[model samples]
Target: MYVAVKGGEAAIDNAHRLLADRRRGDRDVPALGLDQIVEQLALAVDRVMAEGSLYDRELAALAIRQARGDMIEAIFLVRAYRTTLPRFGYARPADTGAMLIERRVSATYKDLPGGQLLGPTFDYTHRLLDPQLAGDAPVAAPATREADTRAMPRVSEILTREGLIEGDGALPDDREPGDITREAPEFPMERDLRLQSLARGDEGFLLALAYSTQRGYARSHPFVGEIRIGELDIELDVPELPFPVPLGRIRVTECQMVNQFQGSAKAPPQFTRGYGLVFGQSERKAMAMALCDRALRAGEFGEDVTAPAQDEEFVIAHADNVQATGFVEHLKLPHYVDFQAELDLVRRMRAEAEAHTATPVKVAGKAAE
Candidate 1:
């Protein structure tokens, strides 16, 4: 029953102009710069980039500005922009083991190789807001430390060495990991594709799902094995080059969760793993994604799938915020025809019911008379 209604071109144009005017704000105040957004509102930019599945800081910052700081809107813009870019080639898998570590820590271990470096985190900070931040205040420089050049071993590797945790199986040399961007997602997806979806999934949605597990909805009794944030070199193998060449470095956050599993007939008792990796310093998103990732692997480990997070079809289909928002927001568009049809049907049914009520019911003998 959808009907086209066209005559709002002028109104649409005026609305767009109003949006631009509102985005600019007060004339007396200076317009916000992209550089300021990149450096000052870095976490917001990072979130937009991570969810948008794009790595360009400049573009993400610009999207944030254009969206008037609406994160979902900003993400949509970046994702839309990403579709137009040409694909040169896929980069080699990032080797996080050799990453220039910024912040690395483990709740399971107090002392590990490359002892916990709490770099630029709000973990210990009080939640109270400072009035000084609202005004121009002199800022102090961050403390410096000697760079640790040694390769920091992954915490999961330690558990794997002791046979306490299951190993991440290596993929076949001939096979490349599935890319969700290039193809439609099918149910019962492989771990690689699932990971890719979770990496870019809505943070709040994943967070709620992760929280549900802790409350005994498909409980896994998980522990944060390690969380690391740092920069890693991205290399691309080109036909013209003899070997993979370094493209540049990008910051990322990786989280590993260890969940205990009981022994089944096919396997012995061991600790299972959930992994999350996302662009920029998104520790919360990484941790939540890891929890959901493990929950979704219930089938692989002979566990009952009893939760929303464990449902492959449900999680995969609804993870993308852009898709979710688009569908949800489309309801605001023209539904006049559809509503009119429904209204007419309801009115007709009501009138028929009223008419039938008004008609007197007669007894069998009296009706003939």
Candidate 2:
């Protein structure tokens, strides 16, 4: 027997209250502070910042706390908040080359100009848990010695030194760098917009797409040319501050990949570029991102293509997690109205077909004996 249901408003209110209670656990145990989440769950905060397109650690932390540790939900919170923020004059594009690099390594060169620094990585660490202590207090890290010497050159510079890699010198000027947020994507695009989408894309989605390439769904032999993580200086053109003011720094992850080169008779064989950037030391995400970027770039040059990753329109359009999650999860809402309509349509169609077949057809011509 079917029963009529009511109490939509009361049910929602009760659910909200329950959620609030759960979010803020026991009164005896202190509620998790935003700072505590930011410091302890630093990587999640990084993903929120990267995907949300904002660099505020406090806001990221708050989003994480509010989301109850759901990364995508935290990202949605940050993105929503970021839109409300006033547009101050744009900062001069960050010089990642001049970054106070914490970690830098290149697989392309064994010995480059600036030596490889494997700064702060869990790459080689064992993933097994150690139950030495249940409670461990945060402690201050040791200070580092200042490098008072000359500025370090990029590892790419060494490749440019030998004229192997393309320096940013020969770029065209006819087309301007389009802002993806400000404008809709127009076709016959450059590498910048494509990279932006992949960089801010959901980690899991990008990871799966990248994994497909390695699993023979799409094949592009790629080498991690370099991966760097560091504090990048933020220079803002503030009217109040007038001169380019230093707006502190934020940690960043940068990955560069060297992929298989396909040359035409007209042009010499040159290494193609795949680049990725995130807010923190997310090497796996960055590497996956780089592969996707390289795959998309296949359309730019006339590379023999037969892969899902190589589809430019499909990749760029669907890469946004915020959009995907919204459309996907929106189905969970009251779709009973739509579902009922579909159910009626299918049942009626089936009944009509059955009756028509069962009834002796008015023969246009003589029925088969």
Candidate 3:
């Protein structure tokens, strides 16, 4: 039986007040604005939005501020707020093939159509901390060239045409993909649901699992077929409108990892693919997600599912940081009654053992007799 404990109300209120005070350190200093976070700390905001499963930049920035720069806490705030909002109809599938390309690169090809545009990447930057950034420094404008309006084709398509890569099979009956937000996920999930889960899954968890795969824990001999970061327009099908209504564009990152697969009896020897798509320019998360996605598909390809990443139930169950945090953090709550029961049982066992030991001096069968 559970017993409720009281009398911490005043303490709880005081603790909340202390938290507020701590959150606003140095009142003399100017407060941080939401615009500054949205523009300068863009990546952190992006992560909060992606993991929180909300796309509003302003809301994400506000959450970040409210959480005192705690990313996970900010994500929790965003998610909590998101649940209160009503759901609208799903948007049409985004066509990455026509993405307004910003940063596009391919490891497999030396140079592909729409030559590698290294747009605002830190790939070549030295990791040294610059002192200039500490103080007010004048930022120079980046040089730009005429926009490349040429069609940027996906790298996988080239391989697919030559029968060198596995093709993405058409959806059965062209059914709408499942929404995990609306329903609980089941084990042995379809790729669509799995991708949806991975898209919003904890980046660090996915990164570690992906790293494990690279270290021979379910290696697929993967290559970066393509990684693209850009903006894409979203369209929603309105029942009344004759045509799909256009929603505002959103920035996203897409990764396609090509893995070597020796042909099975049912299929020819060709390259397989793992896909990842995420909100904002989250290259690392997207890439890691793709690796994990490929690892999770081991069962489909008749490969042994021995690794943690290969276990669908394990990955899916532990992917949500919000849920994981809730389960873990809930331990901090009062468990007085439950703990008291355990304590009583332990003490009873100890007392019984002590009594038995003290009484044993009489000896079995009465040695004195």
Candidate 4:
């Protein structure tokens, strides 16, 4: 039996060459530009940024191109690059309440303070692919309307007016964000840590967990109180500078989920909140994150934590797609020593069983004689 391993430096080199060729595709065809990926495939870029935990669209676009549009791989590339970046002083968290919203909508309210700006969305479009887009087609005249530049108010504020929503009552100045990347997610994580993890967590994984909660695994009746996709300023207060320096605007998606809760002896019943804010305009990811966030807070509301999403430890541990992928794919690598040990144990067990059976048969035959 000849099973020769073909992996070596030469094979690896060849593989890389082939990958480069494949990525570029046909030479006659126009190669994808980084700018094109960032502008045209904006949603894909958004996913990479959100999951990569990096805000730079240019870097994310480059990663996507290098990864051959494999989003998970692109995320891995970005996260790896992020580790090499020097840490400047942390900027104050962008205020979402004062965000220059591009798209703002609410499922809980018919009309919000800032009228809903439908912005660029696929929600109303038919799913069928237009043949005209096969080649570059001239862009049609865009529909024009008076831009709704109104400063949007958070929907939770309306509910809060009547004491219908639950909030920590702490002012914004009283809080600080914890970095999940710097520290391991120990049990009983702070709300900041939880949000940090969920924001960068695998979108599909979060979506499934959220779906589970909706299907009665951990029933938290959630309504999209408000979903706003916008750009917010990142400001750093440099000691040398007279005022905070503007670090430019970042596109982000923020979701606030209003869930039904009942009062226990400790507190009065009010609508509880689950929130999600991601690095890019990813409404689906944000919404799913919000749902899962509420599920993880089951214990806070005195609810039983039976579902997978409700268990904070489990969710956080498996939320990182990069980590999960590494753990799973590593099984395909050389496990020769581990498998050999298992094979030896199994062979010994089978021999012992066979001998025991023969001895029993021999003893029975002798007794009959």
Query: Would you estimate the TM-scores of all the predictions?
Result: 0.94, 0.88, 0.94, 0.92
lDDT values of the candidates?
A: 0.91, 0.79, 0.90, 0.88
lDDT of 2 at 66: 88
Candidate 2 residues 1-369, lDDT tens each?
Answer: 445556589889999999989988888998888889888888888888888878888999999888888888989998889778788766777888888888889887777666777787887889878675467856579668765455666666666667666554234778665578788987655677777778788888888888887787666787788888999888888767658998888898988877776577976676666778888768888988988987877766766678888787777788888888899999898867679889899868766766789674554332443
lDDT of 4 by residue, 231-321 (tens): 8999998889999999999989999999996676877789998998998889999999999989998887778888999999999889999
Over 4 Å off, model 1 = 1-4, 169-173, 355-369
**Which runs of model 3 end up more than 4 angstroms from their true locations?**
1-3, 354-369
Q: How would you encode candidate 1's per-residue C-alpha lDDT over 172-214 as one tens digit per residue?
A: 6787899999989888798899999999999999999999899
How far is 354's C-alpha from truth in model 2 (Å)? 1.2
For candidate 2, the per-residue lDDT at 303 reads: 68
For candidate 3, which ten residues in a row score worst on lDDT?
Answer: 358-367
lDDT per residue, candidate 3, 179-209, as tens digits?
Answer: 8988888887988899999998999999999
Each prediction's total of clashing residue pairs, residues at least 3 apart in sequence or on different chains, is: 0, 0, 0, 0
Candidate 4 lDDT (Cα, whole model)?
Answer: 0.88
Q: Name the better of 1 and 3 by lDDT.
A: 1
How big is the RMSD of model 2? Answer: 5.7
lDDT of 4 at 362: 42
Per-residue lDDT, model 3, residue 12, is 90
Instruction: Show where candidate 4 strays beyond 4 Å.
Output: 1-7, 168-176, 359-369
